[model samples]
Target: MTTATPHHLPGTDLALEQLPKVSLHDHLDGGLRPATIVELAADAGVELPTTDADELGAWFAEKSNSGSLVEYLKTFDITTAVMQTREGLERVAREFVEDLAADGVIWGEIRWAPEQHLARGLSLDETVEAVQEGLEQGVDAARNAGHRIRVGQLVSAMRHADRGLEIAELALRHRDAGVVGFDIAGAEAGFPPSRMRDAFELLAANFFPATIHAGEADGLDSIRGALTDGRALRLGHGVRLAEDIEVSTEGDGQVARLGRLAEWVKDRGIALETSPSSNLQTGAIAQWGTTLADHPLDLLYQLGFRVTVNTDNRLMSGTTLSRELALVADEFAYDLDDLLVFQLNAAEAAFLPVEDREALADAIIEGFEKAR
Candidate 1:
C-alpha cells in the first residue's frame, strides 16, 4: 500500500521539484490550496465539511479515493462554489500558480470552465478577466520569489451546457491577453464533442487550439468525436485509448498492437494528459485495476505516444506533478530518463509558440541532465 507520508523516490530526494517541468492539463478550480480554500470558502459563504486545512485536504483525498467519478466530482462543488465571484477566482488562480511554482513548474496551462463561474453574476468575460488578473499576480509573485513560472489559461466550456460558442469567443477575445487555448470539459459521456460543434468551428476558424476531455468517462467513440468534431490538439486523460491497444505476451516482454484510432494518436504525437491519481479517482482506468500499476501509461509510453504526467486536481488527487511522477516511477520502475521524457512531452505539447516550446524543452533537458 502507498504510505500516507510523502517521500521522494530513492536517490531522487525532492530534487524532482527542482527539475524544470511543463504542465499541460492542470485545472485552476481543481488545484486550490487547502488553507486557501478554507479562507476563500469562508469569505464566499460557502459551506465546507471541515474548516481545518489538513482535514479539508484529507477529505478531498478520501472522497476522491472512492474510485467513482461521481464521488470524485462531488468534491469540486466546494472548490467551485467559492470560486463564483471575481475575488474567489482571482485568489484561487493566483495561489494555483504559486503552488505550481513551488512544485517546480516552469510553465503551466490552467483549464477552467467560465460558464460554471457565472452563478455569482459574473459574465463570461468578467470571469476570464478575473482569472487573467490572478494569473498575472501569480506570475509576479513567482518572479519575486525567484521562481520563474509562466502560466496560460485554457478556457473550457462545460459540454453539458449550451454556451460553447460564447465561451469560445471569450477565449478568442482574451487570446492576446492571458488566455492561451480552448477546451471542452465536464460530463464527457453523453455530451460528446459533437455537441459543441459550433464552438469548435469558431475556435478552428479563429486558428485557436483545443484539447478535449476525451477517453476519460467515455470510450473510443468519444475520442473520435473529440478529434473529428472538437478538433482537439490533445487528449485529456486519453488513458482509455489503451482499450484500443492489444497486448500479447512474448518470451519476456510483451508485443502490442494499436488500432487505427490509437495509431493516429500515436503517429500524430497527440499528447496524453495522464493523471494517475485523478484517473483512478474518476474510474477512468477501472478496466485495468484499482492501482497505479494498472495504469496504461507505461504501455502508451513504450508505444511512443506523447504521454505527459499531470495532476488533474492537486487538492482532489492530493498530488503534485512530482508525486505523480514518483507514483508512476514506483509502479513502472522508471528512472530519471523516463521522467525527463514525460516532461519533454508536456513541453513540446504546450500551447506556446515554436521558439518557446524549444526553450521549454531545453530547460527540461538541462534539469534532467543535472539529475542524472
Candidate 2:
C-alpha cells in the first residue's frame, strides 16, 4: 500500500514530495490505503459503499467535505471496523510508514485509540503489540528500500469514553515497545481534557508525554484544560488558539496582542499541530474563512508560536505532508526556510529524548540546506 512518489506538480517546477519532512500529528486509522480498506472490508465481511478504489477515495473526500463532524467521523467507523484483527492493524500500520517514507517524511508519530480496536475481542495489550509489530516491520521495509524513516506510537484514549485511565496505563505499559506518548482525541468541545484529569495525572506520575485534541472543535477553554489538566506537551490541531490573539494594523506596522492564554501557549512553546485541510473540513477555522488561505497558521507562525503543519486525516483530506506544506506555502508565501522551520518545530516537539530530537533537528537542517 505504499504510495508512489509524485514526480512533478501541475503548475510548479518544484516537486514538494521530494522534500524531507516530519509528521507529528498523523493518525494511524486516518491514513489507511483506500484499496487496502476495500480488500480488508471484503475479508472481514464488512460492507463498503463503494468497492472501487478511486470512487471510494472520492467518497471519503466528499463525506469529509460535507462540513459535518458526524459525517466526518463516520469515515473512521469504516476504517476501524476492518482493523479489528491483528493482521489488519499490522498491515495498515506498516503501510502507513511506507507511505510516509515515500512522501519524504523522515520521522513521524502515528496516533490511534487502542481502546477502539478491542471490539473484535482483542485485548488492549494485544492491540498495541499488533501496531508496534507493524511499525517495526514498516521501518525495516523502508530501510531496505533505501529510505530512512523513524516512527513512534501515540496511544490515544477516546475523550467521551471512561477508559482514559486504562488507556493511559496501556500506553505506559508499552513505553519501551514503540508507544512513545498518550493522547485524548474524540469530540473535543463537550468532552474536555479535564474529564480525563486522573489519566493525565497518571501519565505525569509515570513521566509519559501527552498531546490533546483542542482548539479545533472547541475554543480556548478546551485548550486551557489541555494545558492545565491534561498537561499536554502538544496540541492536536490547536488552530482555534488564534482566537486569543488580536491583530491590529497600525500606521506603519501591525500590532499583535496576545491574550493570557495565547501568551502562555506561545511562551511555553506548546506545539500547535495545525492541519489546514482537516481544519477547514471540521469547521475549526469557521471564524476565519472557508479556505486554506484563511487559516491562522501564518499569524501564529509570525507571532512566535511553534506552528507545525500536518495532515490530520490523509484519506479524508485527500492530502499528504507535501500537499499540506504546499498549501501553507501558497497561503503564507513560505519559502524553503519557513518549511524547514515547521519540520524543525515538529522534531523538537516530538516525544523523543533530547539527544534523538537533536539528531532529528540536525537532519532537518541538512535536508533543507540541500534543497535550498
Candidate 3:
C-alpha cells in the first residue's frame, strides 16, 4: 500500500507478503498512515510536529525508537487525537484494513481502546458502531480489489484507566456485530490484569474471548495474573514470558529449562503475540538481549511454544506484517517452512469459531504451498 513493495525472503524468490498471515496484536491507533494523520489533524485543527507526511512518519518512528516509554507512548496521543470523531474513526479503520489486506493479512484482530477516542463526544456504543462500519467498508473494498481478507475488532480497555468493566460489556454487546473479543491494553507494569478481574469474570461468564496485554512491559508474575485473573485466551506481546526460561550449556549442546509459568504457557498452547521491532523499541526483550537476533522468540519457538510473529504497531514501528516476518526470518534463519509454522500457529490461535479457524488454517496451507 505504501511505496515499499513486499519484501522477499533472502535467498528465495518467495515474496513474504504473498503468504497468508494472521495478525493478533495489531493496534488500530498504531497503524494510521502519516498522510491520513496530516489530513485528519488539519481538519480537526490539531497541530502536529510536522505537516509533511514523510517527516511525520519519520517523527513517529523517531519517537518510538527513542527507547523511552514516555516518548513512545506520546506517539499514540497524536494518533488517538485524530481519531476522536466518528468520521475519523471510520476512515482510519477502513484504511487500516486496506493496509492489512495489501500486506497479505488474511485475518487480523485490531485492538484499540474506545475510551481514548471519546473526545468528540461519541458514546461508547456509537464509537464501536463507527469502527465496525469502517471495518466492513474496508473489507468490501479489499474484496473488490481481489484481496480476500477478514477482520474483527478486539475492543481494548486501557489498563491504567478504570473502565475495564464498561469496555468489556461493550465488547459483549457488539459480539454479533464486529467485535470478536475484549482486551486490556496500555501500561503493563504497575497495572496487573488483576485490576480487571471483574471485567474478565464478566467476559468469562458470557463466554466471550479475551487476550490480555501482559509480559511486555512486565514480567512472569503479570503473565500469571493474565492467566489466573484475566483468563486471557491469548497473550498480547507475551514475549517477556521467556523470563521464566533458564538456558544453560552442557557437554553436548545447550538446553533451556522452563520454569513453572513458562511450562504452563507452553503446555497450554497459549499464543504469544510477539512484535520483534516493537518489543525492541519498548524494551520488552531487553532482559533477553539488545537486538532482534537476541530476542527470545526463537528460543520460545524452538522450545515448542505457540509463538506467532506480529507487527504490534505498524505505523509506530514502521513495519508491516510481511516486514515483521521478513525481519524475524533474517534474524533466525527461518525458511519458508518455519514461516508457514508461524502463520499456522496464528490461525489456530485466532479467536474465531472452530470451523472458521479450520478454514483459515486450510487457506494458509494452500497459500503457502502456492508460494513455495
Candidate 4:
C-alpha cells in the first residue's frame, strides 16, 4: 500500500517519495518496522531494551549514533534475535517489501545474512525459501494495492564467521528461485575479502554477481580486496573510495586527481552505494567532516563516479530513501534532474540482467518525466 509522501525538496513542491527509486544497499535486518520488532520479540521471548515501538526506534538511533562500530553493530543483535524462525523471517521480509513499495521504490535488493538466522535450527536453504515466500506475498500485496514493486534477495555471508563458502553455494542454489546475488558483510576492518577468497572464487566461477562491504569502516586496501579477492561487481557503502582521490584548489576551482585504485573503480563504472546518514553514524565519513554537507557524495557524483544514494539502515538512521535523497539534495543544492540521475544510477547498478536493468531505467525516466 502507498504510504504518505511527506518528504519534499526544499523550495519545491516535488515530493521525493513520488519519484521512482531503486535501493541497492538497504539491509533487511536494518529496515524492520519498529512495531514488527516489538511483536516479534514478544513472540520469540527475547528481551529488548524497550518494548515500546517509538522507544525502541529511538534506542536504535541512539546506539547507531554512538560513533563506534561495535556499538553500531550491537543494534542488529536485537533485530536478528527475533528473526530466527520461519514466521519471523517471513513476516520481516514481507514487511520490508511493503515498506519499500510505500517509499516509492519500484525495485529493491534486500540483503541479509541467512547464517545469522539459523540460531533456531532452520537450514540455510530453508531460511532463503522463507524469505522468498514473504517477498512474493509482499509483491502481490503491493500490486493489489495498485503499487508495482519488485524485490530480490542478496544472500550475505557474515565476514567474522567462517561460513562464506557454504553461504556462497546456498546463494547459487537459490539463484533461480529469488536470489539475485551474493555479499559479505559484518566487521569490515580485520576480516578482509581475502579471508573469503574461496567463496568469491566460487561465485566468480559460476558467473554470479557480488557486492562486498568495503570502503566503509575500512579504506582503500579493503576496497582493493573486495575488487581483487571478492570480485565484487558493486561496493556497498563505498564512500571511502573518495579517500584515494586528491582534491586541490586551483584558480577559483577545485580539481580531483584520481589514484590508481580510484581510476580503476571509476573507469570500470563500479557503483558506490553512498548512504549519507548512516555514513555519518558509523564514522564512515569521519575523515571528511562530521556533517552531511561534508560527505563526498557530491564530489563523487560531479566527478562522474557511478554514485547512488541509499538509506543504509532506515530504522537506525531514522531516515527513508526519500528522506535521504532530500537531505543530500539540500546539502548538494541538487535539482530535479540531479535527483533523477541518482535514481538512474541505482537502476543501472542493480544486480538484474541487462534487459531488466534497461526496463527499470526506462520506467524511472517515464516517472520522472511525469513528475517534471
The candidate scoring highest on lDDT is 4
Report clash pairs, candidate 4. none
In order, the Cα lDDT scores of the candidates are 0.89, 0.90, 0.92, 0.92
Instruction: List, residue by residue over 184-226, the lDDT tens digit for candidate 4.
Output: 9998999999989999999999999999999999999999999
Clash count for candidate 3 is 0
Against the true structure, what is each candidate's TM-score?
A: 0.96, 0.97, 0.99, 0.98
Per-residue lDDT of candidate 2, residues 1-372 (tens digit): 366556433345778777778999998999998999999999999999999998999998898986655567878999999999999999999999999998999989999999889988999999999999999999999889888899999999998898999999999899998999999988777898878889999999989999999999889999999999999999999999999999899999999999999999999999999998999898989899998888899999998999999998998899899988887887777877788889999999999999999999998888777665
Candidate 2, residue 116: Cα displacement in angstroms equals 0.9
Q: What tens-digit string does per-residue lDDT give for candidate 3 at 192-295?
A: 98888899999999999999888888888989999999998899989889889988999889989999999999999999999899999988888767899889
Q: For model 3, what is the C-alpha lDDT against the true structure?
A: 0.92
- Cα deviation of 369 in candidate 3 (Å)? 0.4
TM-score of 1: 0.96
Which residues of candidate 1, in runs, are more than 4 Å off? 1-7, 250-253
Task: Mark the regions of model 4 whose C-alpha exceeds 4 Å error after superposition.
Answer: 1-5
Which 10 successive residues of model 2 have the least lDDT summed? 1-10
* Candidate 4 similarity to native, TM-score: 0.98
Q: Give the TM-score of candidate 3.
A: 0.99
Residue 64, model 3: Cα distance from true site in angstroms: 0.3
**Which stretches of candidate 2 lie above 4 Å from their native place?**
4-12
